[model samples]
Target: MSESLQTLQTGPSAAAPGDFGWHLGMVLRGYQFLFEEAVEGMPAGIRGYQILSTVLHRDPPNQQALGAHLAIDRTVLTYLLDALVDAGVVERVPAPSDRRARKIVATDNGREILAQYEERVATAESELLSGLKEPEADTLATLIARLAMDVHRSQPGSSPCEAMDHLP
Candidate 1:
């Protein structure tokens, strides 16, 4: 097995010294739970919701452009779009500029679902950040956004750091 895989298998049950991987794993687990429990029924995960929301406000976003702006892989984005299409929350239309390219647009149902889920996500996040006051929460958000923009500007070929970035 790969060294990384082996380390993952034998690492401390909880995060330990020099265990950034373990901490990231825990964060992913928590995110999955929070998303599934709080936002699953809302038409998409946070990523999907963001895509739909963006498309609603800015329709006819070609897949490549969407992938670039959202920093999602085209392959993974294909599946996410498929799910949304299957759910009747979004539609893919052939791009007017390029027949080979397809654009994503939010359906009416998608808009409603996204709206509902956004509220739920806000509630869940507020609960998670309850320890901080409103001003602190706002400051944290601003700082995180700045950090994400910096990382994105610096990383040319890297997929977005999911934790540091948001759907927008």
Candidate 2:
């Protein structure tokens, strides 16, 4: 028999398919797939939307900080920002405190698109969690955020985006 097929037949597998890390991975993948579809056709899809949202919600110190916070690499963030800057969705303006550093800010158009996308994405997320009761969903979100924050604190300087970096 083929090695791959043999492994699948004999290898350890999650007992419930909804247990532990495998279950988390499956859920996250589902959400990512749904979110990708949710943000389609809006300039670089989810990545661009995230960048725009970051700029809109927080005044990150500079491109580097934004990249770090988004868990995107500096080079990737630069490339992504190039399209956003060209499309006039965001601008890197010189920071008042530091001439060399530039802060990201969303333009009017970027904000508008982000607002629309936010509504759509929220609906998509709601639907994704539709199986859960409202309180369960809220508790889940809160717990997840708290867990992530704990991880961030424990693993200083690691990109949160790294969670999705290895997925197929």
| Best-matching candidate per lDDT | 2
Off by over 4 Å in 1: 1-32, 57-60, 161-168
Each model's total of backbone clashes? 0, 0
Clashing pairs in 1: none
For residues 65-130, what per-residue lDDT tens digits would candidate 2 score against the true structure?
888888888888888999999888998899877989888889999989899999989988998899
Q: What TM-score fits each model?
A: 0.71, 0.85
Computed on alpha carbons, the lDDT of every model, listed in order, comes to 0.75, 0.85
* Per-residue error (Å), model 1, residue 1: 42
Stretches of candidate 2 off by over 4 Å are 1-18
TM-score of 1: 0.71
What would the per-residue lDDT of candidate 1 be over residues 1-85, giving only the tens digit for each residue? Answer: 8877667667458444557656556655665666566777655476787688678776635988888877788888898899899
